[model samples]
Each structure stands twice: as C-alpha cells, then as structure tokens.
Target chain A: MKISKEEVHYIAKLAKLHLTEEEADKMTEDFEKILSNFDAIRGVDVEGIMGETFKTTEAPHLRKDEERVFEDKKKLFQNTLDLKEGYIKVPKIIE
Target chain B: MTITIDAIKSAIEGGERLTEEIILQFYKRIEEREPEVNGFLTLCRDEALERARSIDQKRKKGEKLGRLAGVPVAIKDNISTDGMKTTCASRMLEDYIPPYDATVIKKLWDEDAIIIGKTNMDEFAMGSSNENSAFKVTSNPWDTKRVPGGSSGGSAAVVAAEMSVMSLGSDTGGSIRQPAAFCGVVGLKPTYGLVSRFGLIAFASSLDQIGPITRTVKDSAISLEVLQGHDPMDSTSYKGEASSYLESLEKGVKGLRMAVPKEFFHTKGLDPEIADSIRASIERYERLGAIVEEVSLPLMEESLAAYYLISSAEASSNLARFDGVRYGYRTKEYEKIEELMEKSRSEAFGKEVKRRIMMGTYALSSGYYDAYYNKAQKLRKIISLQYQEIFKDYDLIISPTTPILPFLKGEKTNDPLEMYLGDIYTININLAELPALSMPCGFSKEGLPIGLQLIGNHYSEATLLRAAHQLEQEIGLKSPIRKEEV
Candidate 1:
C-alpha cells in the first residue's frame, strides 16, 4: 500500500488535479497510511453478499422523460464564469 | 437555560411582533461570542433583519406565519442559500452564490425562519474535526480550546451557544451527530431519503443526509416535521407518509425493546467515561420500563473501511464537477484547458479533499475497482443485513455518539486516520442508511458534553424521537447555556 510519487501524480491526474512536489509527497504518505488502515476491509468474510447500490427500501423513481424546460435558465446560466449566448464557454478541448 | 423554539412561537402567536426583538436578542449573543467561538463564516445580518421586519409587519396584519415564525437558524456552509455564499468552508466556492436555495432552506423560509447566516465547517464536509475548514476553526462552546466536533461543528456550536434557536447540518459519516454530541445539543441524522438533498454540496452522496442541530430533543423532533417529505428534484427522496414526529415524541419508552450493540462498547478508541455514560443511559432506559439487551453487529469493524471506500469513490466522481469551467475558482495561469482544470482543482481543494479525491480516483481506477470499491459495496450489504436482523426484534439501538470526547483543536488534524476513527461508532449508521439521533446524556469530568446516540430502523424516526424525548426528561442535562452563562 506504499504509494509512490509517480502513483500519486497518476491518481491526481485522473482526478484532474495538478500538485506541487510538497503536496504530492504529503499525499503519497497519506495514501499509504489511509490505504493501510483500509486493509481491515480485506479481513472481513463477505463471500456471497449481494451489493445494494442504493440502500433505500424504495427503488429510485425517475421522472418521466419529457421536454420540460427550466423556468430559471437565465439564473442557472449566470453561475458560469464565461457564457456565450445561453451556454457556458469553456476552452476548446479538441484541435 | 433552555432555548426552545416555543418561546418565539408563543410570542408571535400572542400577536406580539417580536421577530426583530428575537433576532436582535440572538444577534447580540452572536456579536459577543462569535469571535471566540468562530462559528459563522457569513452572518446574514442585513438580510435576516429585513426578512424579520417584514414578518413582524405581516404579523401586525394578522397574516398566518409558518410553524417557525421569525426564529433565526444557522446553516452549515455546505447547504445552498440563493443570495448568500455557501462555501462549504472551501476557497473553491468562497464567493459562489448558488442560484437557488436548498430544499431545506426554502422550507425554513416558508415557515418564516430567519436565515441567521452560513456557518463554518470542514471543507466539503470532509474532516471529523472542524479544523479542516479553510476559513476558521469552530471551538467547543463548553471549552473554547476544544473543537465542536465536525464536520457540522459550526451548526452545533451556534445552537449550544444560543446564537441561533436551531441550525441545519448535513451528515456524511457522523457530521451532524458527532458535533451535536461534542457541543451538548440534540442533532438528528434522519432516515436517508427522508429529507430531500437537492442543493446540498455533494459529499459522499449516498451517505450524505441533512438533519437539524437543535438545543433540545423536542425541537429536533419539531424541526424534522418541517424538513421531511417528497421532493421531485431528488429521485432518492421518499414519497411516503412519514409519521408525525412531534406528536409521537411524547410516547413513553415503556415496553420498548432497545439493543445496546456489544461491538460499539469495545471500539479501540472508546474513552472510559464515554462508555460509562452510554451504559448508564441504557440502564436508565431499563429503569424507565424499556427492555434493554446487548446485541452484536459482527461487521461493525469492517463498516468503517467500507464507508471510506464507498464515500471516497463516490466523492471522486461527484467532486469532479468543481473544475473551473462553470463556477468556483479557476486558475489564471494555465495555458491549456486540461491544465486549467487540473491547476484550478489542485489550487482550490484543500489537502483533505485532495486526498479523498486521489484515493477515490485510485479506488475507481482500472485495476483497483473490484478489490476496493466493489468489495466495499458487497461488505455494505452484509453490514446492513446485520442491522436489519437486529432491528426486527428490537425497537431501537443505542450507542455512544462518538468514541472520545471533544479533543483540543489541532489534536488529531495531522493524523487523518486518527481523525477518521473518531466516527467509529457513528459511520455505520450512515452506511446502513438508518435514522439516528444524538443527545447530551452526560458530561465529562471537565464538563465537555457526552452524547448518547439512539438509532432506529429505517423510517422509524417517530420511535427514535419518543425514546430520545423520554431520555431527555430523565437525564435533563442543562442545555442552551444562556447569554449570561457565556
């Protein structure tokens, strides 16, 4: 469970984060200690238990898929840092 | 010494427009103690005063007010407030004013509850101690040196210090109850899905539940009446008739079968005094005519590990939304889009939040998913099944709300694992999605409070409230330290 700097960077990259050397080193140690603490889960004998995705007794009820519009689209659009027309503006992801 | 909601309610009922008077009374206390306590991040002074004055003017017009008329309530920073900043105690959302209010906030406004302010908390509700809050540390009201256990420390401390009549807090692995216990208030983590979670900043979505932190057990019951019910916005929110919690609260605990989970007593960090206090609460229940029995939840130890894995894994995905594109902090120096997101998140999220996202990212990574995340999921079922079996025969379960008393600020901050263990007795209830409550049962020799956690089966809040109400009468801990006491 000893996390290397490379592994920490890889995980951080996957999480869409960049880290300073100090934070990366600190996180490397943290991941090791936390993951070691989590080893206790491996000791439990839960051989055949079925996973309950959401634990509520009632199943998740989804609203009917309809073309309903939001009354506050302008308000919702206002939170974005950059807006073009009614949509959020982000830096181009593709060439 | 009691600060019940009834005082404000009764005054307004008698046609006295005391909204300004009540808000100002609590406002005076906040001005006095807030610097020492460090409870609130943003005080809604002008807005709250305006809202309270309007309510008073309406009262003069004989307009009917909602159940909570002009009583100010503190909100933990994570829950969304439309015009006010809901930072979740992180720099990322430091000035992020949500477009709409959380369902709970809207409900409170409807009832004419004055919005006291947004209180400080562990950033993203990530830490056990309030120290993780990027803004400030909320101290235990009883002993200013000690922490008001988090991640809802601010909410609990405000209620304990009588800054607000009641407050709202979201619990993900003991956020609400542990703070309530540490600060000597009644905090409830209601049944999962009982209260809607439309606008709560996500922290382990499945385990995250919003509940009240109040000065009294009955007030906790009364607040739940306003907080629960169906929400079309939240698909997970329940659509069933929940019991009338306030009415059923007066039902005595006679003939009720209560279980004291045997495993919780021997939890590694269990302080001797906390154990003794919880045991005494159980004995008192017996003397009051409820049958108390000791039961074992064999998967108790494993539940903590599962909680971290599942919560962290979920947090990894949920928190990915904080990328600089839409709202929150964005990096100014990044040249590329990916670089912008990466640097923005890295610079914005605190150490603990980063650690969780990294751990979660690792857990959900290609090779580790089955061994870590999926295994935790399987183990969750085993833990829930154990509680389900025990609940069929027992009316309720009880345990020490936290393994240890409120430690001094910065005591466990350096060691995240040590901080994580503080929720040993409280995390599994969230994992099992059961409703539970914590109330001040006793005090440590130093006078820092000890809380007794009363747990109930799913949607059994009425029964849990009844037992808590009965215990409140029996124990009668001096709650809501008055302005003079401070």
Candidate 2:
C-alpha cells in the first residue's frame, strides 16, 4: 500500500504524465491511502473463478472488406493542433 | 405552462406553447440561475432556438414529428457534440470541438430533442465531487455551497435547479446516480451496453454507460426509450431488440419482490437520517402491497478495490488518446514528441485524473498486473455471479444511493479515499452490469436530499423505472430547491 515518490514518478511516466516534485510528493501520499483501500481485494481468495474480462456481450460485427471511394478529409484534419497541407505535423523525429 | 416533459409535450401539441417559446422560457430561467449554480459549461442558445423553430414549423406543415418533439435536453460535456465544445471539464480539451456527433446525440436529434448546452462535470468523469472540474465547481441548487455529486454534477444540478428539463450523463461507478441523489432528481444507469458508447469520452469503458438524469422517473424512462439500442459505431453496443420504456412504467410495485441489502444499511459513514429514509422507503413499498425482504451481499466489501483497479486500468488506456497529435491541448514548448505528450497530459489532467491514471498504470505494470488487476477481475466475476443469484429470488434490490448526504464543496477534496468511499453503495451495480435507478426519497434534517436506489437485473431498466415512478408518486418530495422562482 505504501508507494514511494520515485515509484509514483515511474507510473506517471508510463501514463505519459510528468509530475512536479510537489505533485509527486502529494501523489505518493494519495497513493498510500488509495492503494490501502485497493488492498482490500487482496483478502479475497480467487482459487477457482476465472478472470472475467466481462467487457461486452455483443460480438464484434464484421463489415465487407471492400475499399470505399475517397471522401473529403477536412473533418478529420480539423481537430489537429498542428497540421500542414494534407498531413499532420508532429515534433521532429530525427536529428 | 408546466415544465415537465409530459406536460410540455402535450402543450406543444395542443398549441398552448410553441417550441420556440418553450426554448426561450427555459433559457430565461437558465440565464437567471447560471451565475449562482454554475451548471452549464456552454449554452447553445441560438442553435437550440433555431431547432425549436424548425420543429414548430414542421408540425405546422403537417410533417410527422418525433416523440420528443421540441423538448430541450442538456448533455454532459463528455458526450460528443458536433461543432460544439466538448470540454470534459478538463483543461486538456478546453478548446476542443468534436466534428462528429456521438451516437446518443444523433439519436436525441432524431427524436427532435433540442440540445441547449453541455453541462460541466469532473475531468474525464473521474471524481466523486464536482470540485474536481478544472473549469469551475458546480454547486448543488439545494444548497449553494454544497456539491452536486459528480462526475455528472452539472448534469444533475441543472435539472434540480430547473436550468434544463433533462440531461445525459455517463456513469462509471455512480457518477450520474450519486449526483442525481444529491440534487433530488431521478437518475438512471441503464444496463451496461444498453446504450451506445460510440462517441463518449471514455473513462472506464466497461463500466461507463451513458444514461439520463431527469427531474422525474417517467422522463428518465422516456429518455432511455430514445437513448438505448445497438449502434454499429460502438462495437459493444447491445444488439437486443428495442422496446418502449413506456410499456411498463405505470405497472406499480404491487406483489413485486424487493430485496433491501441489510449489509449496506448501517455501513460506516452512512448518514443515520439517510439510512432511516431508505428504510422508510422500503416500508412505503410494503404498504403499497410489495414483498420486501432483507438480503446480504457477502462480497460487497471487495467492490471498491476491484472497481478502482478495473476502472483506472481502462481509464489509463482510454485516456491515452489525448496526446498532442489528434486533438486537444498540446504543450507549447516540448522539443520531442514524448515530452510533448507527457507535458500536455501532466498539465491538462486534474488531480483525481492523475491519481487514477497512476493507480491504473501501477496495477497494470508488469510485476503488479497479476496481483492487483487480475485479482480484481476475478472478484468482479464473483460479484457478478452473486448478483445473478440474488436477482433469481428478488425482482429488485433497494438501498441508500450514497452512504453520505451531499457534502460541502471542499470537505473530501483533500482525501481521495474518503471521496471514493462515497461510491461504495453505487459502484457494485456497475460491476455487475445491472440497471440501477436513484430517485429522491426524502431529505436530511438540514434539508439536503437523500436518494433511494432500486437495482434490477440486466436489461431491467423498465422494472427499475417502474418502481422508481411508483415511489415518486407516493413520496411527494418535489425538489424544494425549486421553491424560489428565477
């Protein structure tokens, strides 16, 4: 249940979040309380039950594999924070 | 003219009130109260008025009208709105406007339901208290300083405050139900997959089901009639044949076998008044000729921990799409793409969101997955099976919707665990993928509202709403918050 500040930063990194020194300290404390609550699950014994990934009952519907003709691409491109001529712009990849 | 859905619909059809006039009337009331309650994030006044005018014109031209013709409804910010800002109450997507409508939004429009605005909520639908909203904390209309329970706080608050007639809210662990309980309104979390999740801003995918928050149970049933069904866009959308919720709404609880979970009654932090009110509600059902009995949920204690693990794990995955490239806020000063993502997320996400993400990532991390996430999943199966057994003997399960009454704005904001414990009663239903409805049962000694929850098996929304409507008719606590007119 106890999480160190270093571990908090590591998990935040995995979540693509960068915590400040203050945030990390506070998060470590929050984690202690939260994980302790989550620790209650440890008391539950699951010897026979299968792990239920019970997400959805609906089977994924398959569509015809044929390709469709092109439509205007403006809607998809509109939300991009940065875009160029018919392409999305991202930070430079190579030196 | 009355503001209730049934009354309004009749008035619109009777020519007693035009759709445009109805829109303007609600807008006038909303504008009067928005400054105090902070219920709305964005108001689509012009667009809503235009829609209303069109509906009136259509009816005048002998055109067939939709069931919800000219009724105005608010949507939680997390549900997508085409050409309107869908902020999710996060700085992360503060300026983001979705290009396509969410499946529910399209359905609402098809029914001629007017979209007035988006209601504020906890960031990414994460927190129990509305204070976690990055923009502004929404206040309970009943008490200006108290919270409307979250992450659908504003959605519920608006209905309670009479800012809107009804609203759409997504429930992941009692977000919609608790807020509706606090605000003294009717809220329903339909069976998981009963409604489409096509364009919902995903929080915990498996648990997150979009439902209606309304002033009356009948309105909620009608709203569900429009909101439920299969959609190809959302792979998990239920494919069952659609049925009208109106069919069984007036069917009272006479001879209905109801179970009151005794284990949930006197648990820690439960307000004594709230507990007594729920007991009284059960007694009322008995007086109405229903069979009520006390039952037990042995695995009730393990629900919260398992809920957090699964929900946070799903949230961590669902929220990963908020990187700089596709949409939403991007860091202005990151040289590398990874840095851009990290900084954007860190800056954009609020405290509760960050905590959940970290918790999820830790549980899902290599060494801990089996111990935490996997254990929780097995517990989920156990809990689901136990609920299935209970439903075989009982038509519905009843309990206090939340352990505590609506707290003051900053009371539990500092302690995440305390805020989380508020969801103890409501979370297990989501885990079991059952339909649960919360309606105003009574008020505390101090006059804040308390909710009684009625839960039913999968695809049992009709039964839950029927019980809620029956209770609503007998228990005549019409929100005292609306006592003072705008």
Candidate 3:
C-alpha cells in the first residue's frame, strides 16, 4: 500500500506529533514497506474464529462504585507540571 | 567474584560472601563499565547497600533467607520502583517517581533480591535497537560499537558485563530475547498472564510480559519461580497453581517432540552462520534422545504483520495517558489543549515512538480500522490457533532467536523496516502467547554471539528450560567476552 503524504500528515496529527517534512517522507517509505509485509495476512482464511481482544479468561470483576475521595491529592498533584486553583491547568481549549 | 545469579546465591548461602560485599562488587563493576556500556539509567547504591547489610545481619542471626537473597538484579527502566526514577528511558518521565512499587518489583524485594539499578531501554520499548533511548545507547558488552539488541538492551548488557547477577526485562515482541541473543545471555519470555504486568508502564499491554535475563537457564527458571503467580492487582495474571520452575531443571528431554517450522529456517535475509548454528543445535537435541521433526506453520509468516498492527494500535491507546495532564513532562508554553498535547509529545518522545503512535492512530482511525485493526485481530486468532494445532503434534519448537547478530549502532536507525526485521524469528512466539527461551548456541565470525530459540507450549517453561539447558551444555560456548575487552 502506497502511503500518501496527506495520509501521513493526518496520522501525525491524530498521534499529536508535529513531524518535519523529512520525517514524514521517511515515514512514508517505512509505512509502505511495513504495510506490504502485512499484506501476507490477507491470504489467511479465518472465517469462523472469534476475535480475541484482550488475553483475559473471564470478564473483569468490577468494584462497586463508591463515593470515596482521596485525602492526599497533594502527592497526586505533585508530578503535575502545570496547575492552577488545585486543578491541572492546560492550554485553553476555548477560542 | 563471579556475577552470575547462581554463583552469587551460593557464595552468600555458604557463608563465604556477605551481601554487602556482593553489592559493593556490583557497584564497582558498574563504576568501571557503565561509562562505556551505558547500561544503567539510575543506580540505587545507598539503598542496595542498606538492604545488603540487613541481609547480612539476618544471616548472622541464622534466620531463613530467600533463595535469591542478597543478589543484585537490574530492572528494566519501565518497571516502577517506589521512590526510584523509573524513566522508561524517555524524557517524558525524566523527573517522575512512582509512589508505589510495581508488582514484579515488590515480588523481587520479598524474595530478598536487592535492586542495584534500573537499566536503559528503547524509549517506551518502541525500537529494536537501544539507540532510540533518550538517555543513551546501550552497547553490546561483546563489542562496544554494536548494539545490545533492545528495547531491553540495558538489562541484557548488565548481565553480560557482570554488573548485575540477573536482570528483569519486558518483551512485547522480541525485546528481551533479541537483546539476550545479542549479548549472549539467557532470556525467558514466559507465557502471557503467567507473570503479572502490574506496575509495568504500559506499552502494547496485551503482548507485554516481564521475564528474566540471566547467565544460565536454571537461573532464569529460579527468577521466574519468584516472579510468577497470581496478582490481584494485575487482572490479566494467571489464576492457576504456579509450578516450581527450578525443580524441573534436571529433567532431560528424552521423549519430547521438537518441531522446526520450515518457513522459519528458510526465510529470506537470514544469515548463513546463524542458520547453521541453529541446525547444529537441533542435531544436538536429537542426539539427546528427543524426536525432532519439521512442522508446517503456514500462518507464521503473517505473525510479524499482525503483531505490529495490533501492538501499534494498542500502544497508541496505552501511551495516550502521557498527555502532560496527569504526570510526567508537560510543555510550558502552548496556546491550546491540542497544541499542548502535540508539543509535549513531540518534545518528550523520540522519533521512533512518535512513528509508532502515528501508525497506530492511523490503523485505529475511522475508515482504516476495519482494514487494519480488525483484520489484524482476526489474523492473530488464526496464528494462535495454528500454534494450538502444532503443540498437539510437537512438544516444543526450535529456531534462531534472532535472524541476525548484533549490528553497529546507527546501522539501521534511518531504515525502520530493517530494524523491525531483526525480530522476525522470535515475535511469533509472543503473537501466539507461548513461553520461549533464547540461549547462546554459537558465535559469528566477527565473534559476535548467535542465539537459539526454543518455543514451548503454554505454561511449559520447565520443559523449555530443560531443552535450553541441555543445549547450553552440549554447545559449551564461552560466555560473552568481559566488558573491558570491548
């Protein structure tokens, strides 16, 4: 499969990466080769097999929802680099 | 003192060596070799010494000591250790310290194993060579200019350099085995869910498994004994009785049926010397009274493709947590949330990581999801079912752990596809979710080590180790040259 530059740009945008033109060109070649190799899977016949999403034997046991609050939010917030008013601050999404 | 885990354990138990002394020796080795090899990301010197001294005190009091008590083990940087910098060899987590230990780390501490340091890895375990690490490239101890195959390169290099008795490494595809093969050490990637993944920084979660990199198969088995079992914290952990991996070491492969898939051997781009060495190892097994045969796995060729698609898709989602919002590095300047995520990821993650994330995001995107992600998952099931059928006919399968020997640093960095090809022979085992061990079988003319891989049925780590240990004796290859030579 030939990967177009526009497709590469879209992928980079979705992945939150700002790739230079040189990087995108290189990635195009890599993506093409990797996709070609994967084309071998197209020949395999898997009609009735069920999809194995996660390697779990049974459904995950969910803990009952409770209104427990963390007493020490300080440690949790310690690693955050940007904060304002006890909440993690990020670049404004609003225009 | 010898740095193998078994030797260190014996010396400590025999009253001839103190834990403090062994810990000091490892520190000295690190001080001497780490500058050239770039093995460790963070050295826990004071803490290791303190733990060692406590173990010595326990010995003096004649208290019961754990099997691996006092042994210094290096952990791959991705596994979390409380109060220690678990960077995953990426700039994103450079200053972040985990408040709790990973389940594997807690298990090792409970077994009395002292953590000497956290080792380097490919940033987020994305690349095949250690050169992708944001910290530094880990050189093969056998040859300084070449790579210690990655992303678990640092863990394998420490064992090869005698800086640590044993090390823990994670294998998503061929991270653990490829490095162990390159460095001429024993690496075991146990069956998925056999060892808990709790505390391992997620990278392709369904495929990721933590296992041992050691000098000998017995040592690998012993380490697995401590690392395996159910963990309530990791929901994917196996819920069955854990076997004594060490107890079955002496059991020979008398009647075991070993298979060699013809496709694995006859594949293109395989080095001639590596193929011959693997063939010779198979002969040795046949001589040991095991029935060897060639089995057909037509679906094996598609495994690498399916693996990359599934793994990349999962990695994109898994790494989404590092958006500079919760923890780790955050961009100081940005105009919007989208800009913050873009700039932070681009600045903190390496090129290879970004490439994979981009590929994964594309694979999982709206129009392409069916053609890429869904198809890959269906292919994964076919490949797995093929293994189930093969296992019914064969007790184990043997092949070259890696198709090629260690290459010089930067050899394939620009050519990502070439780098991915290095993992061709071993990734299938992970795709099938089976246990596999990579051990030194022979050496290249350049004197670089070549490894033979043994893939086993589910939970058949004991039998796999027995075959590998038997071949280890038969081949009698010298350990990788000391770090000073390179």
Docking class of 1: medium
Alpha carbon deviation, residue B194, candidate 3 (Å): 0.6
Model 1 lDDT tens row, B1-486:
466788778777786547887788889989988988999999978899899889988888999988998878999999999978889999899879898899999999999899989988999999877998988898888999999999999999999988988999999999999999999999999989999999999999889999999988888888999999999889889999966878787778899999988888877879999999988888899999999998887766577788999999999999999998889988888777998898889888998998899889999999888888889998887778788999989989999999999999877888888888888888989988999999999988988799999999999999999999999999875854553421
Per-candidate iRMS values, in order, are 1.6, 2.0, 2.3
Candidate 2 residue runs with Cα over 4 Å from true position: A53-72, B481-486
Please provide TM-scores, in order, for all candidate models, with all chains considered together: 0.97, 0.97, 0.95
Candidate 1 error regions (>4 Å): A52-56, A71-74, A84-87, B483-486
- What would the per-residue lDDT of candidate 3 be over residues B1-486, giving only the tens digit for each residue? 335667777778889988898788779878988999999999989999999999999889988888789888999999989889989999999998887789989889888899999999999998878999998989999999999999999999999888887999999998999999999999999998899999999999888999999988878988999999988777778888999866777778899899999988787789999999999888899899999999888765577778888899999999988888778888878887888888888899988888889879988999888777888888877777778888988989998998888999988988887788788887777777889999998898899999889999889888998888888877764755443311
User: Can you tell me the DockQ of model 2?
Assistant: 0.67
For candidate 3, give the docking quality class from DockQ: medium
TM-score: the better of candidates 2 and 3: 2
Kindly indicate the candidate among 2 and 3 with the higher lDDT: 2
Per-residue lDDT tens digits of candidate 3, residues A50-73? 676434233344344567675667
Model 1 residue B91 distance off true place after TM-score fit, in angstroms? 0.9
Indicate whether candidate 1 or candidate 3 has the larger DockQ: 1
lDDT value, residue B347 of candidate 1: 84
